[model samples]
Target: MRSRRDDVDDAAAVERALRLGLVGMGEATDERAERRLDRFIAAPDGAFVWTRDGDGAAYVGRITGPWRRDEDGAAVDLVNVRDCDWVTEPVDPGLIPAAVAQTFARGGRNFQQTHPGDVEAQTQTLWLRLAS
Candidate 1:
């Protein structure tokens, strides 16, 4: 799998996002999206998890925060955090803070994580960066 996939003018789109410091869901999964961008899909319960397998996604990534859908689109409340697969919804680029935006920009990572559900097409998954 590649790093990321952007069907549109990704270079330009990412550039714009960098200048503004934000991202969009559509842009989240386009080209090598699944490999690059991963998120935690919370269950109906209040609890949340990281690994897509052990808990959420087995051997996938970590879960960041809660899920909230609003004018900004689907979004997750990310606290003072770093290095983990965060929750996501449709989001407004402007709503995202610069620091969080920077985290997303950083690419090329892999970690010991789990995969959620079975081998499905759209299983709630999160991105993982392997540790050295």
Candidate 2:
């Protein structure tokens, strides 16, 4: 549940983000990340999709997927990093990745694969520390 956070300065931001860039965490020790990704895809149809970093704080909604509709309406390669979950409350409607959402929406694609995206997003992995 890696949190998406930023530092006081952009320099700090870049450093922080780059440090853990694709270090492969969460499921690092075990295949937890892979399993989590699998579980995310296995959720009920229409269920949203997101990834929590190893530290558990950094999460970005999988906006686009491996295949996405380009402006021309044709399937084209997309960055697949459009997470809009923060738009609303406990969870917003359309905040999840459009492609992932489509699977749930259409009840298709038994498995949703996680690709490489959002490397810089790891700058400040959010680790929400609840009060003791």
Candidate 3:
């Protein structure tokens, strides 16, 4: 969702823009959106991120830069972005953990943190294998 504020440098501005209904054609925003934006803005460099494309291609990457507003991304409805050093190849579907697969399958346009026990362990294992 595009924020009305050009300078969305912190979570508070993002929260305000969202609450005022000034983002993305007056789309409804909620606590989840606020939390997601907060995490996106606050995530440290080197944090891992997983995402799937519209074509169902999964990718794994590390955050290499800070978040910023990319006006160029407006056409794609992805104005807020972070630079990532994604693995060159898409991850094999069979290799993805069950929790990760479920996250993708749920199909919401919000960033979410995976559960902490099995999901985290499995993801770390997958990351090690991929990084090697």
> Judged by TM-score, which candidate is best?
3
Best by lDDT: 3
How many angstroms is residue 33 displaced in model 1 relative to the true structure, after the best TM-score fit?
8.2
Tens digits of per-residue lDDT, candidate 2, 1-132, equal 221222223223222322322111121123654564455434443223433223323233322223221232111111111212221112233344344333334432222443334322321131121101
lDDT of 3 by residue, 5-119 (tens): 3444223322332332222211126776666777787877767777654456776766677766666444434556666666556789998888878877876455667765587
- Model 2 TM-score on a 0 to 1 scale: 0.22
The RMSD (Cα, Å) of candidate 3 is 9.4
Superposed by TM-score, candidate 2 places the C-alpha of residue 69 at a distance from the truth, in angstroms, of 14
The 0-to-1 C-alpha lDDT of every candidate, in the order given, reads 0.29, 0.28, 0.59
Better of 1 and 3 by TM-score: 3
Name every residue pair that clashes in candidate 3.
none
Report lDDT (Cα) of residue 126, candidate 2: 17
